[model samples]
Target: MPVDLETLYPKLVNLLLDPVFVVDESGNIVFVSDACESLLGYTASEMIGTLIFDYLHPDDRERTRAEANRVMTGHPHTNFENRYLHKDGHAVHILWSARWSEDDKLRIGLARNVTSLRRANQTRDALYRISEAAHGADSLRGICDGVRQVIAELFPRNDLHLAFYDPVRTVLTVPDWSVDRANDWVEGSMQPGTALAEVISLGQTLLASRDPSQPGLGVITESGLKSPGPLNWLGVPLISNDSVLGALVIESQSEHIRYCAADQELLQFVATQVAIVVERKRAEDHLRFLAHHDPLTGLTNRSLFYDRLETALKSAGRHNSLVALLYLDLNDFKQINDTLGHEAGDQLLIETARRLEQCTRETDTVARMGGDEFTVLLTDISDLAAVDAAVGKIREVMAVPMMQEGQIVLISFSVGVALYPQDGRTARHLLGSADSKMYEHKRRRQAG
Candidate 1:
């Protein structure tokens, strides 16, 4: 009634959860257990006589060879690890226990599929690194780059794209490193119907593959590289405090690589961390900007303008050049405010700031000193004539009619010009001279 030992041994090995392999000195797979079909998606008959090295992950081949040599030298390895490509083309992490059989002139090994365990460890490490990247990076772009790097490690042959939305300002911002961006893409508040836009607006994760039968994202190929097979694209919304702040999109760069539900979950976990850091950094940046900028007109404030004026004066002194300061006041600004209401008055001021910028060179400094008052520092001026010409350009631009509250209104401004060293050397002195000239011009307009 007892079974033969030879037949019973093979049956016991076949019933094992882990796959057993018998390889010759030439590294050919001479025999494999039935369980190998579950591990590598290959039947024993198909794998027999094939070179085991051909199935190894390219990056892990050299180290695996070294470990094989160690095992062949009678040093049996119980916990050796390597990666192999499954039949589906995704990498499968394997833990091996093997020994060289001298009598059989072959290497006998057992293979355990450790892919899930390895992925868990990798995900844990990746989350920690992403947290570091988010908080440690100096800017939003740096944070995005760091997140991309970490993701590339976890999911090989993939790229990450970041797009952030500010609900308060209604601006959509993508890092400069985004892949395959459209030619007309701009940073602003408007919503687009693109894939990434849908992810953000709908606050949902999207898993798309290239499907020839359907109209949506038929093929997920990036612009530069064409994958030989279908590429998977996964986008996860970055949610902060129940509001969608941005999206993190990952696309496969290789052939036949598809992202599954697990991949989406992992990316979402990391995205949560990214959203926290990005929001914190943006707030910090806004505060920093407000410290040196006029919130209403988005122009440089008095404090920063004073600093720049002093710096310009010193530079002019060094080069023996002239620097001019133009003080501007919106004539009858309060009268307009009283007549049209403060809302119309604010609109006029904002429009005035825009016109001032349009009339100046990029090198010139335009600032909002206070309500109805602005200053411009014109550096490296050749002579008084240059200053006069700049003032003329400003006056001409400001004279254009602006529609406020459905009413066409004509605006005017009075500018007082002061030259460094001529109007007095210091910032305070130059400012005083400009103020006096501005008041004198206002009085002259009144008398006329």
Candidate 2:
């Protein structure tokens, strides 16, 4: 092989990916690939006379020498991994294979661009951290974004998407997406939904592959959506508890080649994390629903009420507005409970909470302070008229008779209204004032 001409004898030193190195028997570097600039940031001239061993990453220098010596001895190694020091002082993990360059005085090293491989290895170890973070996510959007970010870090700037199946299998909605969920490849990204259901259910081809010939988002048929455009799609089945939860589809435009197997694997790992997060979020929502709610009444419990009340009061202070507190108790509740039993009473409380909730604007709050006692906080109360209006609405709904177990119970509520700053500032004081007014109103009703 002539050292001066590369094009004349292209077959003698031609490689598409791995950089080939030509060295003398004494291991002095001569010819290198055009990829040297990308891999090592050095031109061929800069590395021509440098000892091959001089450029190896200090950690991999010994192994690199051993591999070269072994290859020189006529034993060819197909694939091996070692680090090389780039001109910028970064360690490059190269997956190299070698053979003698015909003259026996020269050796050629071929390698895949495995700098991304090293990053992937490091990211795989770091997945546990993302997995742990996924545990605390509560909303679907947050969970999707978390999973996407973890994945995007591994395959930087790649399109990542996660879709979930609703209770019905028909709608494949984008529950929420993580970082850079969709890139420039698609016409528009609206967190694709049932729009891609046909492709998702029909696309049968899937596996661990390194094929870059097809784009990831190709499955979605553009004619099906409002706008027809080129899209490449790749999906991984999301299985949890032996059930198919949904499919996570990753995609990009035609400008980008389809995703590779390494990308698919990392996406699958992220999908698994997404499944965990989805389940966790469901459980948390269930727990939250149980805690801040009465099992029977479906009204805010005392805990949530107190927190809201405090916040409302703070808001009222800023607005220089009065907040009206109404403490209501049903007269003869015990009589109904004792004669009709607890289930009947529960129905009555449920109806009562519903009526009370409906009676006021959404900004106002009505909470079950455990049992027949209910508290309502009405912020920005304009005057006594506003208070009367709210109380009147409550009375109307309460008058809607409760038909429980074929028995009609006409329930009357005694509500005491107290104003903030006018009654007392503290929650305890306001509650006491409302309580006192309620009993006084009760007495008036009985006497009348």
Candidate 3:
């Protein structure tokens, strides 16, 4: 064996699972073993004449070249890792061991494919990061942002979209997306039968490319209206409890990058975690909304109104300012409920709340106390005229006829105005004084 080492070199290379290569000083591959076909998806005959740097991942080429330069100059490199492009266009992670052959003027290297091992490590790390985000993010938006970051770490992405489906409304809406591609997909409602809708309907992950044969799977690019030519797209449904809540989508227009089955699996895993967190956040938000807002009109309820009023009083006291409290009651509301039915009465209340909201400024607060009674708090008032004008606007707006069930119903409001520091010093006092004044106005109207 020692007598004929050079004669047995080819036989030894054939027995190794890892690919062996010999390259010249110019980085041209001079010799490549048959095992390259399994490691790089290219046969030795196809890779023998090609430049070694040509097969490397573009982003990793400079560093790889620098390391190779050091290895060629009388040094050995062991277990140096770099990414190369497979013939199928996916990344092939490789761990290389190389030494310079001074007599032959070539670099002899052995390459072991580590793509699966690297992907496994990345998957574990990504899941850990996603778990942290799921538990630590303060809001739904924060969770989505963390998801986007984790995805970007694993792959190159041009656009990432997080859409939420409203089951009750049968519509899909994008809540988070990259800024450059923000307008790529319209943020409003997406109708049924669209690509995203079909994904939700099927509750399956979709991997789409710009292939004409694949209809209804077009890539969404700059201004969702244009054609996405030669791009790759992946969408995974965010499913919770066997229900599809929405989708997570990623798009890439680069020719160098394409998504594969492994990428799809990873995205599906992340989507599952996202779905759980999103569902919990939505439920919490719904409960919080119910606690702070009136169920009937979607306006601030009594509890929230008192908290705001207290805060406003404190601010007013600090600035030596005045606040206006308008207490309003619909006259003969019970008669309308009795004659027209509760449905008509509810419609009237909802419309009245809308008009009251329109009659106030952005700084003002409108709240429904219960049973046909509403209150408006106008803060930081410099003069009484502003409060008077607001009252007049409300009266004029309410004078218009409202349509309820194909019938025109005329409504009137008795409004009582209370000024801060003059009417009362506290929220309770101000509220009681305004209620008493509202009843006095109602009695006067009845007498008239």
Candidate 4:
């Protein structure tokens, strides 16, 4: 005997892997197939009485509703896509085919889960954004900002934190955060036992959510030690060439939202790209520093000195102010190098550089012009008395004895002064005048 059509139709719908749904004009789910349990993590009984729009991802709701209206107006929708919130709190990408039944005054739809395909596309877009940031950004901070923007799209929250590791100090410093509000973790160091610290220490990804059995993550703040307020945290180490540079962190304050393994994997991919960009930027910065600084004393080099002197001269000209240039050479520095050793001579130079730095104001530029010759540019000097005071302070600091190889070594400076627009207008001319006067002072001291 042949089976009846109504019984066979219901059996065929039950066999479909994709979920089929019938909804009233009010958007209430009147019928849902058993496949909904597998596709949305919701049983048919639980979804039957709920509004279809209630399960949609908040960001995709308006567009989905607009499409629903079209379908109810006798138009058939095919391949219409939107995101629905799964029962497990993750987004499920869905493609739908639906049409309205005028006689029954209901809408019938079939939903095909396309979450994996959508995620692949999202990953591609995210990687493209990171690549653009790496090559287009002018500074490390710009690259970080770009990465933060891409991450915000994926996590869609305001509590993201990015902590950078200082290899020399073995510490993690939070450099960027999404939210503007003050939190203990912003611009602060990550302490031991915190989620960020643990990720850095283990060089792995970690996910922490509200669990009474698990210990709370701790943080150090100005107020004191504190635990992170009820939130879900995910952290992934930024690793490059077997070294962990830092961590990328995502935080969710909503009790309903929790990070899963898939989120961790996506963030890890982003972190890898970030580490590469950061390493490249750091190398570029080191090269730039070496180009403008003295390797021995860590002071500004001759090139940098000339650049600053020229800048100061321009500023002085604009304001009709005075700029004093001081030329200094250690007295008998070569003799010290010959009597003692190069190592001892180096130690003396380093100490002298420190004393010179301490004698000048922060606005002054002090540079080592090869060997024991150094230059100081003091800008915005009010009068001759200010110049004399600065020179006198330098003399006093140079008189202090420096220890070299467990022995006391006395050092002094043969100094000369020149004023902008008075001794010379150009940097080259002023530098020459200072050098000539320095030699004159040295000869007078030797004669005396």
Candidate 5:
């Protein structure tokens, strides 16, 4: 039997995966294949009579129109790219191979949906930038700012929120850039059932909408969103080493916007990188704190104290002012440590450090030189009377009784004072003189 080529040709065109479009010189859709419905959510019958420009995304219309005009001028374009509005309203990226046919007075075009490919490229670029942010940023805030900028480029007109969980405090903290409901919502506990909370606690990506069937799982309605339409939210947990550290959330309230499955996947991937960076930065900060601080008392350590004392001596030399060093030995600290457990001894030491800090000015430096022994660097001393007054204040504050391990305990300091230039010139000489005087005072008390 002979075949009818005309009938078979339409069937063959419809069988192709990519949609074929035929628009007249006036830019009206004269013919479209059935495959377009799969790519655009619009049936061929509905699209045939509509203006082709009607489907072009508003942001891409100007460029797309220019391309169309060039094609109508007898130029064929194979690599032109633009965005078209899907029937459901999200953007559909289209790559075109098109030409103008003078005989038919029609513009023939083939469209390949490149939305997924374009998103993949964007994700790759975003990941590289985020990694740079992690390595180059000096602080947590800087890192977050960089990440927010990269994310904003990927999803424009969307609000981004980063909620971090403080495992020690059991609180969720949002950075300052967060907007409206997220700022308010993230302040408290990561309570169960909340959208963000669920993302972190369950270590899962969540897609929520105003649709009743997909209930936002306690999505905050009073988010103060100014847009007048259904709200949509996508949250992905930032997980590191199998632990849920926080959540990265993007929200939109525009009727035309929706958070789809691809968005959820991409965000989740990006959040993994974010969690690693944040965790690394926090660890670096903690290590830096430990290096300069006493672990037990949270005061400056011996090494930092010496550096400050040397700096103070140089400054006092230039200013012609006297600096004093006070070496303090806790009275019978060992006896207390023996009577009560080490934990109670630690509490006493922490309390003593606080009291010592309270007695010193902000300009002075307080340090723990190991084993209930501490040193204070006093700067800008006027004369001997000023030094005496500072010593008197320390004695008065230390005389108060403290409750430790359900027992009333009294603590005092057998303090030794060393004046700059008068006792010794250098930091080592000053420390040696102070230590000798402290032992002398302790021995006198024992004799008395």
Candidate 6:
């Protein structure tokens, strides 16, 4: 058997990079290399004459032997990868090239280390996780949430701020934003030359490790709005369509890694993605706002009123409280439309809605039923006097004349109230009862 290889030229064996082994027809390891000691924790002398099947990872051995048998005919095959048991008891991923020998009594194979390549595959899988997570985020705030989640991988447990630019304000405006929020968000305006403003002003990324160069954020950290603060910070600007649209700002906790250049690069890439999402979200919000709100009065149109009414009804039912529906129709609505035209009539309706809203509590709802018609939902009522008091206040607010082309025109609303369970439980039933009551009041006043 070629003098058992060791008995022949044993010195030539240690030159290969792969863990080479010669197996006899009986599948025993007749010879091995010095590489075996480094790869498998077995010295060549100790492994020689051992079974080749014994050294293979037990789970892979049978399938590997089957594959080897299929390719036993001497043909140069290339590039296959698999795993094997390592010396430290961890599995080693290996790239393999194997072929059968001409002697028919033995076979040989070569392998290359592939651990780094495997780790890269794991990173690719993580990238897929980000894409899947970010897919549903189409608005600025939704985009903010997506960015918050991705950034969470680095900073994990800190809250972050998101702001977007307002073209009219020429400043960074609060985006759909939250504070460590699960679902709630607030959209509003913020002052210029503020903390986020500094980031947008720089027109570049800012990494604040020990101390930030931006005085706005630095001042806030040293001393907050109420008092001074000790927090260190980092801020990055989001750019889209060649302009800085906003800034994504994150603050570090005491134990955080010192924010570095690499961190800035990662943040920049994430912010770019976030900017695209926020832009789309704003467009969608504008469209949605237009669809559900009144173009003239800015009141909840019939559609939205009914939606809110249903929600209020369900909530009132749960609390075992009452819901009062008020239907107001202007007595002189047609006269204003006829004399001053629809423009004057529209102004009167808008002013009426404003006055009604002003008279109601935050929990109360005021809605425009249509031209010359308005509705109010007085919820969580403890007594009938609450309804009487609310109607009295609305009548007083509406009594004030609205200015129309330098003329003060008085508008009176004939208001009607319908109570839940006593008047009706259904929305349409409540509207019918309220409408009938309004006309009855109108007739009684007309006769008097």
The C-alpha TM-scores of every prediction are 0.83, 0.59, 0.87, 0.86, 0.80, 0.57
- Segments of candidate 1 deviating more than 4 angstroms: 1-4, 34-38, 41-54, 61-75, 87-89, 165-173, 177-198, 210-231
Candidates in order have lDDT scores of: 0.84, 0.70, 0.83, 0.84, 0.86, 0.69
Error of 6 at 342 (Å): 4.3
Residue 372 displacement in candidate 3 (angstroms)? 1.6
The digit string of per-residue lDDT tens for model 3 on 1-448 reads 2569887889899789999999999999999998999877899889988899999988899999998899889889888999888786677889999999989999999999988898899888888988888788877777877887988887754467678777887666665344575553434566554556667778887665543443233443444454344336778899998988889877666666666787788778788878888889888889999999999999999999999999999999999999999999998899888988999999899999999888888899999999999999999898999888889898998999988878788999898888898999899999998999999999999999
Per candidate, the number of residue pairs that clash is: 1, 13, 0, 0, 0, 8
Q: Candidate 5: give the clashing pairs.
A: none
Best by TM-score: 3
lDDT tens per residue, model 5, 51-138:
9998887667899899899999999999999988787667788999999999999999999999999999988998899999988899
Q: Put down candidate 1 lDDT per residue, 17-125, tens digits, no spaces.
A: 9999999988999999999999878999999999999888777889988988887889998999988877766678899999999889899999999988987997899
By TM-score, rank the candidates, best first.
3, 4, 1, 5, 2, 6
Off by over 4 Å in 6: 1-143, 154-159, 165-195, 201-234, 239-245, 251-265, 310-320, 337-347, 443-448
Q: Compared with the true structure, what per-residue lDDT tens digits does model 6 show for residues 1-448?
A: 2456755555565777677767765678777778777766778888788776665655567787776675576654567666565543334557777777766657776666775576456445435544655577654555556666666754444446676666676654554443465545544554544556566776677544323443224333333344133334567888878778878777655422334443455566667666666566667787887788888888778898888888888888888889999998898789878988888777777778788889999888888877788899998998999999999998888888688867888878787899996998888888899989998888877887
Model 1 TM-score, 2 decimals:
0.83
Model 6 worst lDDT window (10 residues): 215-224
In model 1, residue pairs whose N, Cα or C atoms come closer than 3 Å (at least 3 residues apart or on different chains), thus clashing, are 210-218
Name the lDDT value of residue 259 in candidate 2: 45
**lDDT, model 2, position 152:** 63
Root-mean-square deviation of every model: 5.0, 11.3, 4.5, 4.7, 5.3, 12.9
- Using TM-score as the measure, name the better of candidate 1 and candidate 3: 3
Candidate 2's TM-score reads 0.59
